[model samples]
Target: MPVVLQAGSFGRIRLIYVLVQYVDETPKFGHTAVDSSSGTPILNSSAAGVSPPTPAFTPSHYSHIYGSTPETLTTIDAPKNYGHAPWPRISPREACLLRYFIEELSRWFDLTDPHNNFATSIPQRARSNPILLDAILAASARHFSTLPSDQKAHIMSHYGLSPLPSHIHDSNSELSITEETVIHYHSRCIAELRVLANEPHAVMDEDLLAAVVVLRFFEELDNPFTSPPTETALHGLHVFLRAQASSALLVPGPRQASFWIGFRQEFNLAFSQQRNTNLPLEITDSYLIFTGAEDHVWTNRLVVLGARVLEFSYGSSPSNDLEFNELVRLRDEWVDKRPRSFAPIYTESPDMDTAFPKIWYTDDSHITAAQTLLLINILLLAYSPSIPRIGPSRRQTLESIDAQIRTIVLEICGMALSNRQSRPAGLTACIAINLCADRFTDPQEQRALMGLVVGTTRDSNYWPTKEAERRLRGIWGWDGDDD
Candidate 1:
C-alpha cells in the first residue's frame, strides 16, 4: 500500500517517513528533505533508489507560466544545411562576459520598478530564442564595456577571466569590443525579425523589441562617441519601432510592447535633435489603442506633451501663445486630476514626519507620480513656450510658472530626502531636480538640493547621478563653465 502526504492542522509540514535499507544494513534510516512548496519531490536516504530498486521522477524547475510553451521559445536542433547559424555561438571570453552581465546588470536594470522586470524577462526570453539570447548577451557586454576599472576587474575575477590593468582602462577599447558584439547580435535580430515583420499581422516578437530597447539604453548611457551613429542609432531605432507599430496597427493584439517602445522613443528624444521630433504615426496609434489605465496612460500623455513642448519650442512645429497655454493647461489638468492609485507625493504632517526615505519604493503609487511631476517640471524649465512678442512681457506668467515649479521641486525633494540614498525614484527625481535647480529660489532649499544630489552619488554612484551633480553645480554657477 502507498501512503499520501498531508499538511498538519496548523499548516505545518507533516513528517514524511520512508522505509529504507542501507548498505550498512540499517532499517528505516533515510535522508530528509524539506518540501517548501507544492509538487516538489522529497530526497531519499540511499544514493541510488531508496527502499525500492526503482526510481521515480525528479523535481522539475521548468514549470510553464505563460499557459503553454511555444516551440519558438526553446532550444532547437541545428540543421545540417542551414543558411544561417542555428544558435548563438560565442567564444569562451564572450561567455565570461555574458556571465558577468547576468549577475551585475540585472540589479540596476530594475532599480526603479520590479513590475515586468526586464532583468529576468530578457534572459528568460533568450532561453527560448537564440537571437534574443545573443542580443541579451550583447546588451550585457555593452553594460560590461562601461564599468569602472575596479568594477570590471571584479567582473574578470568573478567570471574566471584574466584581469586587465586599470591603465588599459575603459577609454574605448571595451566599448569597441562590446559594440562589435552588439552589431553582430543586432544584425542577427534584424534578420530574424525581418522575416517576422512582413507577416501581415502583429507577431509576438517581444524578444526582438526588448533587444532594441536594451540597445537604445546602451546608446543613451554611452560616453561621447569616439564613433559616429549617435544620430544613426536614433534613426534606426525610430524606423524599426515604426515598422513594429505598423504591424500592431494592422492586427489588434496585445500592443503593450509597442506602447512601451513609444515611451522609450519619447525618452530618447531628450538626447536627440529636438527639431527632428516628427515621430512615426504608429506611436500615436499605439497610444490611442492603449486601454486607459489611469497612472500609466496619463504619464505617457505627459511624455507626448513634453515632446510637443520640445518640438514646438524648437523650429519643428509652428507655435503660438494659444498653443503654449493649451500645453500648460493640459499639464495643469493632469496634475489636478491624477488618479488615487498614483496620486502626487506630498509632505505629510507638514514636516514630512510620516514619509519614508523613499516613499516611492514603499508606496507603489509614487513611482509614476514622481515621473509625471518631473516631466512637467522638465518641460516648463527646459523649453520656452515660443510665445511671439507678448505685451507686459508676461512677467506675471513667468513668476507664476516659477512658483508652480518651486512647489513641485520642494515636494519631490522632501520625498527623495525622506527616502534617502536607497530610494528608487531618487535618480529620476534628482535628474529633473537638477534640470530645474535654478528655480529652487531659496538658499536653504538649494543647499538641501545639493545635499540630496551628493548623497545619491555617494550611495548609488550611477552615471546619471554624476551628470546631475554637474548640472546642479552649473545651475548655481559653482562651475566656471556653462553647460
Candidate 2:
C-alpha cells in the first residue's frame, strides 16, 4: 500500500506498507450512505456485532512510523482517578436532557477520544459539580432544542415521559425551547463561576476547566461562525485558560482532554476572522512533543500544528524564510511519521453521482486525525509565502496552488461524508467548506458542496453549519432557493 500526501504533485511522499485486504463489514459507527449531490441520507441503520479488530502490525512496522526504537515508545498511563461525588437531584425534565447528553450529545465532544470520558467521566464529575452540571445541561438543552418534533419525541420516549416546563412552550402549544430556557442553565453556570473565579486555585481545578469547555460549545451554538468576538460575555474563558496555563494544570487526563477541545474551539474562531488565537503555545507545545503513545496524543499533535499554521498566517510579526520553512517541515514530518492506524481501511474513487471520493477510517480518532491533516495542508497552501512570480510564471503558480487546495478540500469532504456516523466529522466538513467553497466554479460541484453543508446542518442540528451555509451561498452568489 502506498499513502498519497496531498501537499502538491512534486510534494507527494509515498509510504510503502503491507496492503490489508478490504473486508465488506459493518463500519464501527454503523453506516449512513449519503446522496452526494443532495447530502440526503439514503440509508441509516446499525449493524449487530462489532467490527473485527484491526490487523496487528509488528513492532518493527510501528517503529518505522514513530521514527524511534520500539523501546522508546511511551505508553500513555494516565490514571482514571475520577473519584466518586454525590449525585445531584434534579427534576424529571432535566433528567431527560442529562440522558440525552450521555446517549447522543457527548459524542460531539468525544469524537476523537476512544475512551469517551465526556460521556463517562464528565457526567460523573458533574454529579457533584453544579457548575459542570449546569454547563452540560445547557449544552444538552440547546442541542435538544434543535431536534425536530418527532425526533425529540423519539428521544424523549426512551427516557420516561416527563412534564414539559410551562415556560418552555411557545404560543403554538407544541413543545419548544425558549432562548431563555437555555440561558437559564447557562446563566446559572456563569453566575456560580463568578463566585469560584475569586478563589486563587479555581483555574487549577480540572472540573472548572471542563465546565468552561462545555460552555464554549454552548457559546458556539449561540454565535456560530461569528467574528473574533470582542464584546462577548464569555470573555472569562480566555482568562481561565491563560491563568490555567501558568498554573501548570494541563497534565494528561480530563484537563488535557479539555485543553484539546478548547484549542480546536479557539482555532475555529481564529481561522474564521483571520485573527490569532489567544491560546498559549508554550503550554500546548508541552502536549505536542509526540512522546506519548495514545491515539489522542497523535491527534493532538495535528491539532497543535493547526495552531502554529494560524499563528504564522495572522501573527503581527513579519514573516521570515526561517519561520515559513519550519512550518512546512513540521507539516511534512507529521504526514510522514503518522502511525499505521491512521491509514484508511478502505478507498473508492468518486462515481458519477458523487463530487468527492470515499475514503473510510476505522474510528473517530483516525477520522479526526486524517481530517485535521487535510486542514493543515489547506492552511499551508492558502497562506504560503512563496516569492512573487510574473506573467506566465505567476499564472502557473496560481493554478498549481488552486489544484493542491481543491485536492485537499475534496479529501476533507470525502472523510467527513464517509464517516457521517461521527458528528464532528460533518462539522469539520463545514469548516472546510467555509474556507474554500468559493474555489469551485462548477455548478454541480458547488451544489454537492452546498448539499453537504446544508445536509450536515440539518442532520446534526449543529447551528454552526447553518451559518456556514449562509456564508457559502453568499460567496457563490447563490439565491436562497437555489440548489
Candidate 3:
C-alpha cells in the first residue's frame, strides 16, 4: 500500500515504504562505477522495477509552493543512448524560448570556460534529457518575462513565440504565457527532481547537476524584490554538490562546469549578504592551479584568488597581517607570471565624452580577469586593517585608500562600458560599483556610474538593476523620485 500526497494540477507524489532485509545492498543496476566525465548512462529513477540501494549522501529537505509532478514534458524514454534519438516535437513558444536560451542565456554559464559547454553541449543534451530541458525552458521563460515590453514583442515575433491563448493574460498583467510557461516547466522539473532525490545514484548524474545549476539561475532572475527569497533551489544545489563530492571524483565535464557556475552564484550571494560563502575553499584550491594552463584557466585562477580576497574581507576569521601579506604576494605573483594574452589590446585615456579611461581586451576572458583583479584590489584596500599613525599620516592613509578605490571603480566602469557584449565583465563591474559607488561624489561621475549599472540590466535583461539603483540613491542621499 502507498500513501499519496496530492496538491493541484501539478499531480501527486506516492511514497511507498519497502521493508528490505539487507542494508548494504548494491544498486540493482549492474556494472562497476566509472568516471562520468565522458559520455555515461543517465539512470532513469522514474522507471519501474529499479530499486536502488540507499545512497551515502541524502538530499536535503526541498520545500516549494508548487507540489507534485505535471504531465511528462517529453516522450523520450530514459536510460537510452543519448544523442541517438530524434528531438521531441516542441511548440512554437518552446522553440522561441530555446532560441532565446542559446543566443542570450547560454553566454552567462559559459563565461569562464572558453569551450562554452552550456552554449554547445548542454542544449544538445537537453533534447534527450527531460529534466535538463525543463530547467532550460523554465529559465528561458523567466528571462523572457523580464524583458522590456517593446523588446518582448519584437523577440516574440522574431522567434515565433506566439499563438498563445487570449485568456492567458490575467489581472496580474505580467502573468502572460511567459510567466505561466515558467511555472509550467519549473513545477514539472521540481516534481521530477523530487522523485530523483529519493534515489541516491541519481545525484551523480552530470546532466542532473547541470539542470539544478540552470534552475539556480532561474531563481536568481525570479528574485528582484518582487518575490520572496526561496532558497530551495540553492539548497538543492548544496545537496547535489555534496553528494557528488562525497561519492564521485569531480571530473572535467558538466559536473566541473556546474561547480564553477555554482561558485559564481555563491560568490554573488556572499558578497551581497556580507557573509562567507558556504562552499569549501579546499575544493576550489584543487582546481585552477595555474601551472601552464590556457588563458581561460589562468582567468579562473584569478577567480579563485578573488574568492580568497572575499573571504578575507567578510569571513569570521580575524584579519591578520600574515594572511594579508600572503594575499598581496599572490596577487603580485599572478600579475607577474600571467601570460601576455592578459595584456590589454588597447588603452585610451578618458576623453571629453567619457569620464573613465577606455580599456579593451582581445578576448572576453582577459577583460573578465581584469575586472576581477580590480575588484580584488578594491576589497584589499578598503578592508585593510588600520595601523597606528600620527594625525597627518592618518589623513594621508585615508586619502590613499580613497584614491585607489576610485581608480579601480573607474577602470571597472571603463571595462564594462567598452566591452558591452561581455555580460560577465558587466556583472563584475556591478559588484565593484555596489561596493564603491559612494566614493564618487561628483554629479557627473555619479551619473556615469549609474549609467553602467542601469545599462547592464538593460543589456543583459536577466540581472535586475532597479533595486541596486535604489540602494545607490539611498547611499548618496538623492531624492527617490529621480532616476
Off by over 4 Å in 1: 1-117, 128-131, 142-206, 224-229, 248-255, 258-262, 271-278, 281-298, 315-338, 344-366, 377-393, 410-424, 440-461, 464-475, 479-483
Q: Write the per-residue lDDT of candidate 3 for residues 1-483, one digit (tens) a residue.
A: 122222211112222112122122222222332111112233332332344343332111112323533234134332322233223424445567777899888988887777788988888787667678879988998888787776777776676455334535442232244554666567656655554545646766788878878988887775642233344566656655655653322455666777678766766666655556666666666543557877877877787787788888887653677888888888988898899989988899897777888888878778878887887787788777664356768878878888888888888889888887777677777777877777778777888888888887788875688788888888777895664
Ranking by TM-score: 2, 3, 1
True-structure RMSD, every candidate: 19.2, 19.4, 14.4
Each candidate structure's TM-score, on Cα atoms with residue i matched to residue i, is 0.56, 0.76, 0.75
Scored by CA lDDT, what does every candidate get? 0.48, 0.67, 0.67
Provide the global lDDT of candidate 3 against the true structure.
0.67
- Quote the lDDT for 195 in model 2: 48
Candidate 3: where is the Cα deviation over 4 Å?
1-86, 156-176, 224-230, 245-250, 287-289, 386-392, 480-483
Instruction: Estimate candidate 3's RMSD in Å.
Output: 14.4
Question: Predictions ranked by lDDT, top down?
Answer: 3, 2, 1
Query: What are the per-residue Cα lDDT tens digits for candidate 1 across 1-483?
Result: 122212111112111111221111111224433211112232322322323323332222123555555454456432233233321233454456555555665544443333434545556555455445555655666666555667767767766667557666332333233444554444443343433434433223555555556555555454321123354234444544555655544542223443344454445345233343545533563442324554545555555565655655664444466777776776677666666656435435334332223343345334544655565555555455542247786776677677777667666666666555334345555655655667765655666677766666455443345555665676676755322
Find the 10 residues in a row with the least total lDDT in model 1. 9-18
Give lDDT: candidate 3, residue 279.
Answer: 63
Residues 1-483, model 2: lDDT tens digits: 121111111012111111132222222224544322123332222332223344544455556677864564445333333444323334444567788888898887886666788888888777667678878988988988877777776666666564354336542222334454565556555545544534665666778778877877876776666444733323445655665664433345676667667777777677766677778787766644555466777887788788888888888752666887887887777777778788899999988888899999877888888888887787777677773546667777877888888778888889888988887888777777777876888788888888888887688888556566677788889886876
lDDT of 1: 0.48
Predicted structure 1, TM vs. truth:
0.56
